[model samples]
Target chain A: MNNHDRFVTDTAADIAAIARTEGWLVPPAPIGRIALRPWQQAVFWGLRIYIGIMLVIMGLGFFHVAGG
Target chain B: MSAETDILAPAEADRITYTEELEARLHDRLRIQRLRSAPRGLANRLALGLALIGPGLLVMLGDNDAGGVITYAQTGATYGFSLFIPLMIPLGFIAYLVQEMTIRLGAVTRRGHAEMIWKRYGAFWGAFSLIDLVVANILTLMTEFIGIRVASAIFHIPYLVTIPLAFAFIVGILVFLKYYTWERISLFVAAFNLVFVPLALFSHPDWGAIGRTFTGSGWALPGGLFSAGFLILVSANIGTTIAPWQLFFQQSCVVDKGLLPRDIAASRRDLMLGVIGMVAVAISIIVISGQYLHDLPNAASLGDHSVLAGIGSRLGHGAMVIFALGLLEAGMIASIVITASTAWAIGEALDVPRSVNISPRRSLYFYAPAILGTAIAAGVLMLPHVPVGFLNLTVQVIATVFMPAAMLFLLMLLNDRELLGEHVNSPIRNVLSVGVMVMLIVCNGLYGIATVFPHAL
Candidate 1:
């Protein structure tokens, strides 16, 4: 095996061993690339809408100050 | 199990192994090995202490950025050695409480603040945080460069010479050095922040009056407690101390430093020292400026440079040069930290190589945000008639606006039993955190209203 893969395997074993001693379960690895969970997606969209509103308010403040 | 199964299973075994936690554990083992190999003596103890000094010292000194120093100077010039001087003492405790939690979180999770939020909470809160952090970091970098420019101008150095030189210096340290070396150099720069303390001594302020102000009713505002000007300065002070970037920066720095659970005590000591040092320097600046410029007409109307000039007139050119040097060092150190915070947060969020230990080629995403932010901020300072006053005010406003959200995520993450396990914040910590959050929200709210209606004061 290549050095990088070997290193990864060895390190992973070490962490698992440590977690077992600590009585903690190692969580399962995510499949494929990292993607947001369903709940996270909802939060992302909610924040986006909030950010949009904040921007409008800020923009209005800018105009008001300049106009004044 | 077959050999192939053993080899491949480990990688597919668990998420924690694939994450930075594995690397953190390896790094911790290496550190312990070094400690074992070392000759047991004062030198060994010193070496261990030095190793634990980076993140906390960097965060606290970096907290006293150009904007903060400028704010303190303005505070002294405006109100003298009244409430604000003594106010910094308790603020230091608040800073320590918030930042110590970051160290614990970093040690326990072996992940940066941004990474924790993204993986645990989801993308919306993550993006919300990243956006606030990146925007605030850039604006704050502008304030740092403004400080550099102002200090340079005091020495008759032009922006043409200052901007590129400062940029190269910041980028060079970040790009060339690994975490260990980078931190030592940063601590060296951070030491110069104490120049203000000695300069304050040279100012020869009335110590008796300064002491009396601390204990007496000088905490009361002349224009009453809820005055608009008073509230705005209080918010600015809070904004300068407990910032959004600090949350990301300290956690990432702790992770990068490879601190383990055993090292948490050393980390706390380092943080306490940093807090003490930061407050001392801030009070020194306030005392010096407040002593000289307190009675000056329109002292509140004076800019940062004007305050320095006033110091020059009172204490001579030498004292002014010392003040300018302190300001320059504050900007340079904070610029390094602010840039690193941005790079670390973005890299962590994207799951890229984020530690300063990685090679430049491997860590391009880790370094790009910082270098770009520094370059753009330095470039902007070159423009003529930049609305610096407006920009500085806006930076504070942005910081205050985003701070509550950042603190909320931090508190939530600290309390997350799944992630922090046994290291979750205790009841007393939660009470203190809530108290700090409430004060921050009220101050920011009052400051916001005051900004919108200046005549309210």
Candidate 2:
């Protein structure tokens, strides 16, 4: 429950019912953790390579700006 | 638990709801949800839209920061009523289209940008992204202080006095205010960004000349678009228009403001308003300088203090003061929003409780980064002869350089069928998003070559 504020009271369940009747869930579901998929690491590495190149070029360009 | 056939008994109704710890964010969000079921009328609809509108407006306006103001000013001063004016309109639409994805991601997923990146992509990219965001934020914050410092100087206030004073106000509001209160105060300050609209009119910009830019003549750059300065300025323009922090900030803001999927359309309208404000302010700043400083011998290199002084000399001290005040407001609002973005990204990535409602007493960790980060940025501002104009433009360029990574992560998240369900990016959006990514890379690369070669362009 570290990520959740756990509380229980059947009284608000009546109030929650009102929201449910209106096509809403009073307390919505959380977007919890997910298992990393197969292609994710590949994609992340590709991102790293692209960013690494951009960073190097940008660093040089910025250095030129600073120096000149 | 089924409701009784009639109203609840007095004894049962007396029981307090959510006794363990009803988070302020959740409580506030639920209150807005109640407003959604209000009777259909213009007033009620307007109220609901206003309540759900913070994240997009904050992100778009927050981007028209110290760097943005200076970059737009420099564009007008250097190129004068060129393609840049018409360019800003399309850029605004592109910004809207790009940022609109974050609304669905945040609303449907109910997770912050950093949290999604961390959980979905794993901790390495998350930590890297967090670091990049914090460092960029600090550098960007220093540029903000420069804006403040320059504005203060216009009024004869020293940096020693103004920088820390602004810092105190920033930290004070952050440590004290809750989400709704803090957001409203920020919005009020953001309204001053429109000061540029009047400044544009005050500059007496030629309507014919401005309109003719849409014709072929305005498309031509004086130094040619390939020139080093022109390329860098163009890249800076792109950088300012669609920044990385914007992606992180808006989504996290949407999550923090507790926007549900039901509120996405309203949030899109909010984003459109933001796009309009952002483009208008940018064009106004460009026109203000285009009217006065464009023909100056050193217009391209005027920087903050000199540009205002240049306008003051022509348009009187009133215009100078107005421009400086706009910069001051822009810097201040961007500083506040950026600080929150940094803290929120850190908190979410690290799994600390992240909300504006987290009192400093309960979790000093939440507010510590903001205070320390601003302190460091302000400390940098205090140093002698910090080439802040170049620094500001450099911050924008840096934003352009690493923008691909930010966009990549965002695109991936938005396309996540598991999380966004029916809200995933459409085929057309995919094409546009990829095009934008490529455009960012090309802009950065072209600037790089131009920077090194100097005369190559």
Give the winner by lDDT: 2
Runs of candidate 2 with Cα error greater than 4 angstroms are A1-68, B1-22, B39-42, B455-457
Task: Indicate the DockQ of the complex predicted as candidate 1.
Answer: 0.12
DockQ of 2: 0.23
Per-residue C-alpha lDDT of model 1 across residues B344-410, encoded as one tens digit per residue: 8999888887887666776788888778988888899878666553345446545766776677778
DockQ of each: 0.12, 0.23
The CA-based lDDT of model 2 is what?
0.79
lDDT of 2 by residue, B219-249 (tens): 7776776776787788889888887788888
Q: Candidate 1 - CAPRI tier?
A: incorrect
Please provide TM-scores, in order, for all candidate models, with all chains considered together. 0.83, 0.90
Interface RMSD per candidate (angstroms): 9.7, 6.4
Cα RMSDs of all predictions? Answer: 6.6, 4.4
